[model samples]
Target: MKLIIGLGNPGKNYDRTRHNIGFMCIDALAEKWNVTLSESKFKGMYTVVHRPEGKVMLLKPLTYMNLSGECVRPIMDYFDIDVEDIIVIYDDLDLETGKLRLRQKGSAGGHNGIKSLIQHIGTQEFKRIRVGISRPPAGMKVPDYVLSKFSKEEEPVIEQAIEKVVQACEASLSKKFIDVMNEFN
Candidate 1:
């Protein structure tokens, strides 16, 4: 089985914010796969989809950003999932807006959510797809920028990026992750 996790704060206020892009892509994937995250476990909302390739779990952690591993580790253990069979989707401040960078392993690069996951999961070698939210503007605080909604001009670009992320995830279900990274990165 494959466990796909999307990291974000859980609340309506966080909806569509730059920090919630992971949740946004997971929501889109759920819709495309005709499954709802109707099951709750380990402080996460999730559902299992039986695809032609295999079983897939789509999860959105409810433990907020900074403590996301408090939710992910237990579910992974309960389900007997290996680190190699998981993929985490989250936002990144380093790349240009709407860009994506996929890696098999890496440091969190100062993302609290990824740092939590790395700490709890005890590995830096898990798969990740980082969606770029861009850096904060001059004089803007990182927290303020990440929690803010996209500007009117950026909406279209972000929407396209989310769609591409969904597609890349779907591709990973059937192809090797390295191939998916090469094709989508």
Candidate 2:
């Protein structure tokens, strides 16, 4: 089984915030595939969907962002999945808005969630699909800015970006990481 995990904080308040875009993309994928994240183990919400290629389990870590690795390791061990079969989608403050980047492995680049995952998994070899959230305007605190919801004007663009990421993910699952980068990066 392939595991596609999206990182974000759980609960109502964090629902539509900028930091929750990863959750939003996974939610979209679940809806598109007509699957439900009904399972409640490994500290996450997940569902196994039978796509044409094979079974894909969509997971949203319930460890609430920073401690997300704890939620993924057990699941990875349970499934005997290699780092190659896993993909993580999350927000990236370093990239520009609406831009996406695909990498087979890399440093977390200061993302707490990815940092934790690297620490627990003992490697940075898993694939990452980073969606740009852009850095905050000058004078704004990074945490406060990321925790905030997008402005109405930014919603359309975000929606499009999510769509692109979803498509990129599907391509990655089938064609390969290099193909996804060529097509979406």
The candidate scoring highest on TM-score is 1
Candidate 1: list runs displaced more than 4 Å: none
- Candidate 1: C-alpha RMSD after superposition: 0.6
Residue-wise lDDT of candidate 2 within 3-61, one digit each (tens)? 89999999999987888889999998998888889999989989888888788989999
- Looking at model 1, the pairs that clash are none
Q: Best candidate per lDDT, number?
A: 1
Please give the TM-score that candidate 1 achieves against the real structure. Answer: 0.99
